[model samples]
Target: MHSFKRVLVTGADGFIGSHLTETLVRAGYNVRAFVYYNSFNSWGWLDQSPEEIKRELDVFAGDIRDPHGVRSAMQGCDAVLHLASLIAIPYSYHSPDTYVDTNIKGTLNVLQAAKELGVAKIVHTSTSEVYGTAQYVPIDERHPLQGQSPYSASKIGADQMALAFYRSFGLPVGIIRPFNTYGPRQSARAVIPTIITQLAQGNRKIKLGAIHPTRDFNYVEDTVEGFISFLESSRSIGEEINIGSNFEISIGDTARLIARLMNVELEIETDEIRLRPEKSEVERLWADNRKARELLNWQPAYGGEKGFEAGLAKTIEWFSNPDNLLNYKANLYNI
Candidate 1:
């Protein structure tokens, strides 16, 4: 494992980023958390983190789209885990401009800053959505990218920009493309959280769209572990790796599984507003994780069918808590 004095985590206040930050601090790494600046001075999910983890973090509030701020955030850090981006697919449909600014330009700022700063390693986040509808089962890193939505399109642009930096400037950048990650603190916009929050709120009739679409779901902790694996392995440099559970299940089946786990009789109702434009829907996704296993020696603790159920149980337990459930508006459509 390569050692670094300080590692910067962009989007540190977010779901996966918060989990990764806490894990790194617990593992005894010097971490600088770069959170988005807001008028309320909110640190997002970090505000809910354990006191010990909060105390260990050195928080830097800045915008990823600002090159100056990004450079300043990376000043003393040897490596960076860039996870800042606008990721809601539905919101992207409403505002494609914001997605372009946040996803594409935000990544460009990180790339330019990392190149100039001589950062030792950079791990950029990518999504499986870029592989629209998965032309084949078990998508590997070599799969062709198809941007079916504005959100996925922006991410595709960002991923290409990261790769271009690696090729043109020889920047030590690695991309960690994670499949659907769900667990505690995930936004309601995602299908899993939407399903869980609705059921936990005593709604037997769950609302969703495009239930036929299959996804390769990875638990949040597993995704966090993938980030750390990529961060430490010198072999990950210049490589694009997938972090996924290597299992496939349709949204409808996933909802039924959650209902069984929660001991609730489920009735799924299609929410028209939640449906993506016909061609924009990614019908299927299953991961081939052999590359991550061989290159980074990484494997999802939550892998395969049984592992998915176990992960869902853990997620349900968390969302079942009244305090957590109160944060979501289960009665309304998330997007």
Candidate 2:
């Protein structure tokens, strides 16, 4: 394990980013949080984090697309966890140009900065979306990448760029590709939150996109721990590893499960507008997490039937709160 204590976490105000920041701070690392700057000075999810965690973060607001901004934020940090990017698939379809600029160019800026700063380690974030509809049941690192959408294409470009830097410049970087992660503070743009928010708002008919598509859902904490494990493992350098529950569940069944946990009977209403173009929708995804287990000595604490049910129950409770529920517009389709 590398002994660096100060690490920079870009996209620190986001769902997974916020959870990872809290875990890093509690683990005694000096954290520098790079949040997207806005006129409202909104810190997103971090604003809701406990005060103790907030105090430990040296928060910097900047745009990752701009090389100068990313470089400035990364200065003085020994390592970086780059998670800033445009992630929504629907949004990406509407804005492919922005996706390329942010996901690809933004990653280049981080890699260049890390190389110049002489950072010992870097943990770049990737997504399961890059795999498209899984070619195999348990998608391994070697599984062929299919860019089914503009979003996945951009991520594929970004992941390749990171690997190039490692091969060309000998940069010590690791890519952590996480499957669908769900929990408190997840944006309503995600399927889990979309279902939970609608059901919590007392909607009997839940509107969703393709319900038959399956996903491997991991809890936020487990994904965060995977990031830390990758950072600590020397063998992870220059490698790409998956962090997931390795369990697949259809979207339809997941919605029904959430309804049961919420003590409500609901009808799954498929909205045409919510559906992706036939070819663009990824029909299924399941992960082979053995790489992370063997390389990082990490195993998912929240996985399998029992862990998934427990995680969903906790997520349901969070969305059940009026305060959190109000943040979501359950009546309208979010992206």
Each candidate's lDDT (Cα)?
0.93, 0.93
Any residue pairs clashing in model 1, and if so which? none
lDDT of 1 by residue, 1-335 (tens): 34989999999999999999999999999999999999999999999999999999999999998889999999989999999999999999999999999999999999998889899999999999999988887899999999999999999999999999999999999899999999999999899999999988889998899899899999999999999999999799889899988899999999999999999899999989889999999999999999999999999998989899999999999999999988888888877
- Candidate 2 has an lDDT of 0.93
Single out the weakest 10-residue window by summed lDDT for candidate 2. Answer: 1-10
* Predicted candidate 2 versus true structure: per-residue lDDT over 57-97, tens digit per residue: 89999999999999999889998999999999999889899
Candidate 2 TM-score versus the reference: 0.98
- Please report, as a residue range, the 10-residue window in candidate 1 with the lowest summed lDDT: 1-10
TM-scores for candidates 1 onward, in order: 0.99, 0.98
lDDT (0-100) at residue 288 of candidate 1?
A: 91
